[model samples]
Each structure stands twice: as structure tokens, then as C-alpha cells.
Target: MAALIVAAGRGLRAGGDLPKQYRALAGRPVLAQALTPFLADAAIDHVMVVIGPGDNARYAHAVADLPTGKLLSPAQGGATRQDSVRLGLQALAATGFDGIVLVHDAARPFVTAALMRRTVDALQSEIAAIPALPVTDTIKRLGSDGRVAETPPRDTLVSVQTPQGFHFKALLAAHEAAVAAGLSGFTDDAALMEWAGHPVKTFPGDPANVKLTHPQDFDRSQGAPLHVRVATGYDVHAFGDGDHVWLGGTRIAHDRGVVAHSDGDVALHALTDALLGALTEGDIGTHFPPSDPQWKDAASAQFLAFAAERVRQRGGRIDFLDLTIVCEAPKIGPHREAIRAAIAAAAAIRIDQVAIKATTSERMGFTGRGEGLAALATATIRLPEPE
Candidate 1:
């Protein structure tokens, strides 16, 4: 079966140059997060994305790290949500897959493997299948005055989500008919099929597979409380006049630099935060204190390698890392790629798995005064669930 992911929404509600699907949630793009399970499944043949016209660059930036062998080029989306869905259906029509087609929203990133498999099963028995959860709250209709008009029966109400599956041909025909009839009020594909006289089956939905509509949604992540850990490190060196400064793994030619016990790589220091977070260890300072004198001038890479080896020894794997560098003088853009490479190399992971970014304190703090560079990082690791 094939899948078409509708990620074309401008995400006006999420409010950013980056759409909601492209937003970072748990250190990964929301769209890439949604696509992972489908790509890993053996039954899925290919996947396509419906995106805004002239935003191929945005799509490219969002999916740069994903293996593109299974991805189709972005199909041009329309002004309305329905238009985007219709366009996605049209694109898949050309691929000529007679098997079932799964339509999913790029904004929903928490879909699970079991739910995805069940969606496919529903398609085998019914022309269209949707995943939904019975509404739990007592929903009420509100009038212009902002008072409840009437209470809707909760038992009959359900909240729906995508990866909505269908017999490939039937879905295509329904979309074509909807467009031809000028009936565009339908908010989802299942509704369109219903209006076209097609019966859509329903399956259970994981509450965690939420659609990210605003920034706050990211702050509330659900699922197995990802084995979370935090580590902090601190390095202080005397100020000295020098031509080169190293922060997080980026090098800048400057007039003065922090004299350190090692390279004074602030980027690595922040990465240690995430690594520690994953390992549930303390910060960099806890592991390597300045009073020890043994680590003076130690290469921060040594600290990172040691941490990684320790994590492996404990039977865990690092999934991704987010590192941010803060400094005053030497701009960061020129060295971003190099910094990414350095972290990935130290972690023994792909460069794409490491995100390196830079920011300034707006000259407000010590870093703003150009005293020294600072970094903050968050890391994710996966360990076997307890037996």
C-alpha cells in the first residue's frame, strides 16, 4: 500500500515561518516523526507529501535528513484543506497502486506501530477506515453570548485522526466526484467518502497521536514517559588574549578567548547536558570538576566519548541530540555544518541525528559581554523497556 501525507497547511494557527509539521518536537521535525513508522513498515510501498506551491524549499529543509528513496516529490497543494487533499489524491492516482491507500496528517506525530497496522487491516475489510476516539468531555454548543446553548450527547461524538485508509480506487473516485460536484465543506477524507455514499469503518486511536495545532501542544508530550535524564557540566578558564576560540565545536578567529583546561568547547558542554539527560547523570561539572586538576586542558571530545561509551555499557542507545551555542563575537553561521559534523562524530551517529544551532544573548548576559561562550543541549536515548 501507498500513503499520502497532507502537510501543506500553512499552520497559521501554530504561527511560524516553519509550519507546525516542520516544528521541532522532542528534537525532531514533527513531519519526520509522523513518517517514521510508515517508512519502517514493510507493507508500505511509497509515500507522498502534499505541500504548498513555491515552498519546495521549506519541504526540502524539513525532510532533508530522511531517506528520499520512498518519498515522492511534493505535490502542489491548494488554497483550502479540501483542495490539498484532492490534489494529494490526484497525485497518487498517477502512481497506479491498486492496494489500499492511507491518508495521514503530517501534523500528528505520535501515531504508534500497532495503530498503523490496525488501520491497514480495516482497509482490507472496508472501503474506507478511520481512527477515532470517543469524546470524553461533555461537549456543549455555545451561542454568540458565550453561554452553553445545549449539551451534545457525548456517546455519539468522537474525535477523529488520520492515516485514514481506503480502497485506492474508491477513494480516488470519491475525491474526483466531490471536486466535480463543487461540494467542498467536508473537513476530512472520510466525510467526503460518506457524502459519496461509501461506508467508512472506524478503529480505535491512541490519544498520544495528537495533532499539533499550537506551540503549547509540544510542551505536553504523552506516551511512555521517555526515560528522561539530565546532565550538567561546567568549565571555567581564565580570560586571555588569543586569536582563536572554540565553542561547541565551532572555531572563531577572535581577538580574545577563554583560557581553559582543554579546548573550551561550549558546544560539547551543552551536548553533555543532553547526554546526561539521556543517562540521568549530573551535568558536565559533576563528572569533571575543575578542582580535580586532572582534566585541565582536557579535550571536551574525551568527555563526550566517555559518556557515550558509558551509555552503551548500560544498554541504551542515543537517538538524537540538540545543541545550542551562545556567544558574542564570532558569528555562528559560517561554522554550523562543521559543528554538526563534530558532534555526530563524537556520538558515533549520523550528522542528521545531531542538530547544531547558535544564538546570542543580545549582549545582555556574560556571554553577551563576550566573556565566554555557553551551550545548552538535550539528548534522547532509547533503552529496552523493563522486563
Candidate 2:
């Protein structure tokens, strides 16, 4: 099978300097996200991306790092998405792949690998297969007076999405037929295939696989393809008489101790806050209240670890952590790498993703007076969509 990703649309509906497909969602381009599943599939022989003439330089820059073996950029596109698709199909047909053609929209970033596979399977028996989600809302036809003219049966209604699959040869013939018939108003490839007398089967579609048609749509779906967030934190503990102090899960003897009910590991506290902030959950206090006796003198690192694991179990991934320690005494430079490693191990992420920095208070405040130590941390996590 091969793929033709229609990205040449002017996106006038989306309205932006860059076409909707080239815009950034999360940290990657929308088209990139949309193409990932197909690129990963061994069955997809190649992928042709059709772009507008003026977008050539930008398209190259946008997809410069994508795999070249199965990806291609054909000549500049015509005025409509259907024209762009036809151009892409001609390029694919030239490549001699007549197995199946999967036509996808570059604006639908949330199309999952599973959905693509399902569509491919359906194409094995039918001339064409389109992902169509069952509509859950009431159906109505409005009159010129803004009244309901006819109520269609909701049971038979379905909202179609892509990557709509078709036999490569059949799809090409269908498009050519449509062109010959002077029909250019197809909202999707399946409809065109149906018009050409090819049976198109329906496969399950993801509700979250939404196309970005307007500015608000992009805003709603932009971000890591996963539904995750990043947050940061910082805290300080003053020095006072105490038996021992905790630092990144290690006990250390100190002249003065941080004043807190817990071990007063300011670094861990800040990081905890950051993690909770990312989850949009309440702060550490809400989870482990100071009012609770069982938490008194409890390890703050433990609390942070629990929060990290909670997000992990929720199908989320922490991408990075940046921790900074500030104090004049109990020098932090020696423990930087060790602390970073420890944090990474606890957060279940790579060492490179975790950073630890140290700075002196410059003798300017309570920390400068050597009364306490302070630490701040930032956490970046990738949260997958809820099942």
C-alpha cells in the first residue's frame, strides 16, 4: 500500500500565515504527526505530499528530517484539495504501487496507528474503506426560516474521517473519472470512489481524530499528540538545629536543619509541586497533608515519587526534569550528577532528561545568611489520551 497525504489546501478555513498542516501542534508539525503511523507501517510503499507552490521552501524546511525512503513531495498543488490529491495519486501510480492507496488529511494529527491498520484491513475485501464514526447527535435539516425541514434518522448517520483506503488502481480510475465528469466538490476520497461505482466499506473511526479546519480547532488539539502537560517547582528550607537532613533520598549531617514537619527537602517539595501542577491536580499538601500525623518527618522524596508513578500509571510519560539547588553551605556541586541520576531513576525517565544545577545565595537572604537551603525543579511529561 502507498499513501497520499493531501496537505496543499490553502487552509483559508483555518486562516493562518502557514497552512494548517504545517502549523505546530505540541512540539511537532501537524502533518508530521499525521504521517507517523503510515511511515511506521512496512506495508506503505511510499507517501506523496502535495503542497502549494509558495509553500515549497517551507515544506522542505518542515519535513527535512522525515524519512525519505517512503516520503515524497510532488509538484506544487492545484487550487483544491481534490486537485492536490489527484496530483499525488498520479505520482503514486508512476511509482507502480497498485496494491492500495491510503488518502489522509494532514490536519488530523490524532489519527492513531490502530485506526490506520483497521482501515488497511477493510481495504483487503472492499474496493475502498473509509473510517466513519457513528454520529451521536440529533439530525436535522434547517429551512430558510431557520426551522427544521426534515429530521434524518440518526441511526443511519455516520461522520466520516480519514485515512480512507482504496485500491490504488481503482482510486486513480475514480479520480480520473471524477475529473472527466467535471465533479470537483468531494469533501473526501470515499465519496468520489462511491460516485465511480466502487463499494466503500466503513471502519471504526476515533472520535479524537478531528481535522483542524479553524483556528480554534488547532488551538484545541495543539500540543504533544498525547494529552499531557509540563510543570515546574521550587522550595526553600532554613537551617536550624536538627539531627539529620534529607537530600535527594540521602541522609546527610548538617549544622542547621530545614524547618518543616516533613524532612524539609525543599528540592523534592518544589518538584512535587511541579508534577502536581502538570497533572492539574492539587498541590502536595492536598495529597499529603501536614495536618496528618502519619506524614510528620516523612520523606518528601517519597511524596514526589508517588506523584511521578501516579502519572506513569495513567499512561503518561515524564520527558524531562530540571532541578536547581541554591545555598552557600552544604555545597551542591559535588552531588549534581548523582542527584540528577537519582531524580531520573525515580521519575522513570532518561538521565539526559534530568538536569541538576547549583547556585550560591550570594549572601542576600535567609539562604544567604546560611539559615536554609532552597531548590527549584521543572518537570515535562507526555500524557497519553485516556482510553
Candidate 3:
């Protein structure tokens, strides 16, 4: 299955200088938070986003540090939300996608894995399915004359939310038909399905999946101060017969290489472990085993990226990554800033958030003897305090 995230709206009502999806929620962009679960989900095969024109820069910055291997090129959006959905569906169809597609709202970033599972599972027996919460308040309908007109029973009412799941071809055809018929007032895709004579099933919705709209929704106090976690990681690689070495995503000229299953980037390996430690996830070996033949020559930058995505998956952000490289050769003085930039790009944080230092072991340790290189890294992160 695939997902199409609708983030094309101006969202000025959210009171941010940028679009609400590009604005910060917790410590990362709202759209990043919204995209994390879907990207991390095993059931989803592809994810695409619809963006407004002139939002290219904002969109790039929003998902800059995320693991987006499955993300397709963003589709340009039209004027209204309905038009954006139709265009997004059309774009997906152009890719020859005919499987189920989940249409989600960018404003609702709290979408959970379980909620997505429920939505997807409901589609097995229905042409269309949506998540909805039962209404509990009294209903009212007033006359245009400013008088009480009628009150309907609240039992029949429900508030709907995305991601609304549907057969891609079915929904695309319905949208085309609606456009041909000059239908313009439908509030959601579900309503359009109703107009096209498709029966839409309802699944239970999550109340915590509220949309962030008002300015106060981004207030730190409303969500409480995040939990601060500090963790350390260390890695060492012995010199072997090679002409180059990889460190922090950079390939440098060297007389020898490190013995390892992967590219043997000690800096990124240590940083990846430090971030996993901060998230209390296992070390690099746990996620990527040395015994795995597929990772025999993989780049370490992707390892760092995977670890960083785990933090985002848990609703946290990396604050700082401080690394100290211990070596007697390769002279770290010149590449300090380059190493920092590479680490920052892999970990999805600003360069200022990364710190790199170098030292020699006073000509006593193995590092001082020039047999190998070692890296020590400490990762600091902020996560929503567990309730």
C-alpha cells in the first residue's frame, strides 16, 4: 500500500510564518512527524506528498534529515484541498499504482501505527474505509431568523479523520467523474465516494490524533518539557591493507584501511551507536550485523541515517552529537568542519549541533603507535516526557 500526504495548504490560520507542516512541533517539523510513522511502517510500500508552488524550499527543509528512501517526488498541488487530493491521486495513477492508497492530512501528525493498521485492515472487505469518532454533544440547527429551528439526534453523527483508505483506481475514477459533473462542494474524499455511489465503511478513530491548527497547539508548555537523554558510544578499527579510509561519510587518502564488514567509518559508526544508545535501542551490531553479507560494503552514512530515523519514530530529536577521534595519522586538523558537516547531514541536524575534536594518546596506546583509529561519541537528545 501507499500513502499520499496532503500538505499543500497555506495554513496561515496556524499562525506560523511558514506553512504549518513545515513549522516545528516538539523539536522537528510537523510534516516530518507526520511522515515518520508511514516511512517506518512495514506495510507501506511508497509515500508521496503534495505541496503548493513556491513551497519547494520549505518542503526540502522540512524533511531534510529524515530517511526518505521510499518517498516519491512530491506532486504539485492545486487551489483547494479537494483539487490537491484529486491531483495527487492522478499523479499516483500515472505511476501505474493501482493498489490501496491512504489519503492523510498533514496537520494530523499524531497518527499512530495501530490506527494505520486498522484503516488498512478495514479495506479488505470494503471499497472505501475511513476513521471516525462518535459525536457526544448535543446537535443544533438554527433558523436564518436567529431562532432555534431543530435539533437532531447526536447518535447518528461522527467526526471523520484520515488516512482514508481506498482502491486507487476506484477513487481516481470517482474524482474524474466528480470533476466532469462540476461537483465542487464536497468536504472530503469520503463524501465524494458517497456521491459516486460507493459505500464507505467506518472504523474507530483515535482521539489523540487531533489536528494542530491554532497557535497554542505549538506551545511547549502544552506538551510539557521533553526528556533529555545522554549516551556515549566508542568504536575502533584496526588498519588493514588498503589505499583509502572512510570517516564520517568522507573518503580520505590513506596508506591503510580499517578491517570491518562495512566501509569501516569509525566516526559514523560511533555516532550511530551513540544515537541508538540515547534512544535505548541496541547498538549498530544489533541493527546491522557483521554476519549479514548484504552489508559487506555498505556505507556508514546510511547506518547513521537509520539510527536518526529511529529517534524521529519515537517522537524525539537529536540535540547534539559530540565526537572525538583518536588517531596518530591522517591529521584531523583540516577535516574537522567537513567531518562535522557530513555527520550533521547523516544525522539530520544542523552543523552547529555537531562537535568534532581530535587527540593522540601520547605515543603509548595502540592509536599513538599508528596501528588503528578509534572514535568516541556522545549523543544528546530530547523526547516527549513519558506520561
Candidate 4:
């Protein structure tokens, strides 16, 4: 069976120059996230997209990193959503497709493999099937006079979502028939099918399968991780015989350097570990072993950059990076802003997202004796919900 994602809509309401599907959700494009589960599902034989007229380049960029073994060339969509569905169906038919087609919305990036399976399983017995959630709030039908015309039974009211499953040939024929009869404005494929005398069955739908629309939707999505990860890391580097020390990617004049394989920015190292920890990845040494000569005397800035990239690669993002320095010889208060800016530059995040603070050990520990510097860091990150 094939899956067709409808992404033709130009969502100006989402408040960006790019189409909502091409806009970044975390670090990846919205369409890319929507396409991920379908691409990984074993049951989906082929996947297609119905795109807007000038969205070729955007769509191409969105799916560039994805394994497109099951993807078909996109079909240009029509003005209306109903028209776009018909075009996608017709395109599939032209390729001799007679199997079930699951029509999905690109805005609903959280569609899961299990939901797709549920829709397809229902299609085994029914020609038309859709995923729907029961409505909790009372729905009102407004009349022409601006009064509530009817109070629909809350139990019977359901909010529908896609990918809506259908028998490919049957839905395509229904579209042609609707056009031949000069039908217009059918809200969805199921509604069109109902007009053509086909009953549409409903199955349980996921509450998280949300359609992103308003600008606030994107704002709210910032905290939409299945897991809000807060990980902490601490690093202590003893002072060796050198003239300068690296702290938070900034070189500070010191009596001695750090005893480490790299330049040993303690703050950067601790922050890197925090980022990796939040991602459940191994520590800094686990990725860049000290035994590797290539990393010897390397800039710790690169280490932090690598960690940041790993988060993006996982379709996750760092929410905050907090660092604390424990030292006595060099006053951290004097270089706090510089440290924050340096860390932000290395991580490619705003300075506001990076927090740098400092404290001493009150002449108690090795830090108080000015033997070495220590850093403590906390990274907060968000990863998309698992499929």
C-alpha cells in the first residue's frame, strides 16, 4: 500500500516565509518529521507527496537526509485540499496503483506507524476509514441568526485526523464522479465519499496527532518533547605548566595550562557532557577518546560543536545550557559575559540561552588552593516523541 501526504496548503497563519511543512520544528523541517514514520514502516510500500506549485525546492531540501527508497516523485497539488487529494490519487492510479492509499496531512507530524497500521487494518473490511478522537467540549452549531441551532451529542461528536485510509480505485472514482456532478466544497475525502454513498468508518485516533496552524502552535511546540531531559556534568582539570588556560572557549592568561589531551576548556567540556548526557549519549571521552592523537591539543570548542550537532542529528534541540566555574586564581566574574558569548558561539545558540556563573571553594579544596579549575554544567534538551 502507498501513503500520500497532502502538504499543498500555504499556511500564512503560521507566520513564516517558508511553507509550514518546510518550516523547522526542532532542527528538522516539519514535512521531514511527518514523513519519517511512514518511511520506516514496513507496511508502507510506497510514499508520495502532494505539494504546492513552487514547493519543489523546499520539499527536496526537507527530505534530503531521509532514505527515500519508498518515496515517489511528488504530484503537484490543486488549489483546494479536496482537489489536491484527487490529484494525488489520480497520480497514484496512473502508476497502476490499485492498493490502499493513506491520505495524510503534513502538518500532523506526530502520525505514528501504529496509527497507519490501524487505518490500513480497518481498510481490510471497509472501503473508507479514518482516525478520530471523541470531542470533549460541547460543540455548537451556529445558525444564520447567530444563535446556537443545535447542541450535538458530545459522545457522537469526534475530531477526525489523517492519514485517512481508502480503497485507492474506489476513492479515485468517487473524486471523478463528484467532479462530473459539479460537486464542490466537500471538506474532506470521507465527506466526498459519503456524498457518493460510501460509509466512512472511524477508529481511535491519537490525541498528540495535532495539526499545526496558528503561530502560537509553533510557539507551544517548543516544549513538545516526549522527554524533557535535564542532564548535569562536572569536569575538573588540574593546572599544568603553561601560560594560558581555556575557559568556555575563551583563552585567559593564567600561570599554568590544564593537564588534558586537548586545550581543556573545563566549562566547554562539562557543557558538552551535559548535552550528550541529555541525549543519552556517552560522555565526552566516550566520543573523543583521549587516546586518539588527533584530538590531542585540539580546541575544546570543536568538542562542544560536535555535541550540539549530535542533538540536531537526532531531531532534538538544546533548550538551555548552564555552566558554573570553580576557580580562585582567575576571577570568573570579570569574564562572565565573555564566557557566555564564547559558549554561545561554539554551540550556535543565542547568548541568552547560555548561562555562565562562578563561585570559589572558600579556600577549602583544590580549587581554593588554585591548583586547577573545575566546571559544573547542566543542559536541558528536547527530543521529539518516539514513533
Candidate 4's residue-wise lDDT over 1-387, tens digit each?
999999999988888888899999877789987887677565788899999998899999988866666899999999889899899888988888888889999998877656778998899899999999999999999999999999988997899999899998889999999989988788789898899899999999988688999899988876644567899999999999999988998888887888999898899999999999988889999999999999999988878877876775566767799999999878777788888867765674556688888999998889989899899999998787677
Kindly list the per-residue Cα lDDT of model 1 for residues 1-387, writing each as its tens digit. Answer: 888888888887876777788878767788876776566455688888899877788778777766555788778899877899888878877777577889899998766556778899887779999999999899999999999999989999999998899988888888888889887878899999999999989999877678888766777653234454434444434347788887655566878877776677777876775677567677677888867888887778757755764565454556778777677767888888777766665654557777777788999878777777777777777654455
lDDT of 2 by residue, 1-387 (tens): 788888888777887888888888666677776765566455677878888888877787666645555676555677887888888888877766678888888888776656778998897788899999998999899999999999999999999998999888888888898999899988888888888887889988988788999988877664345754878887877777876677775566667677898988887888888898888888898899989999999977668776776675454656777888888878776677666655654553445777788888789988788778888888888786655
C-alpha TM-scores of all predictions: 0.60, 0.60, 0.64, 0.61
Q: Model 2: runs farther than 4 Å from truth?
A: 144-146, 223-381, 384-387
How much lDDT does each candidate structure score? 0.75, 0.77, 0.87, 0.86
RMSD of 3: 6.5
Per-residue CA lDDT of model 3 for 291-356, tens digit only, reads 999999999988998888777657677889999999988888788877877776666566778999
Candidate 4: the clashing residue pairs are none
The TM-score obtained by model 4 is 0.61
* Candidate No. with top TM-score: 3
Which candidate leads in lDDT? 3
RMSD of each: 14.5, 13.0, 6.5, 13.7
Better of 1 and 4 by TM-score: 4
What is the descending lDDT order?
A: 3, 4, 2, 1
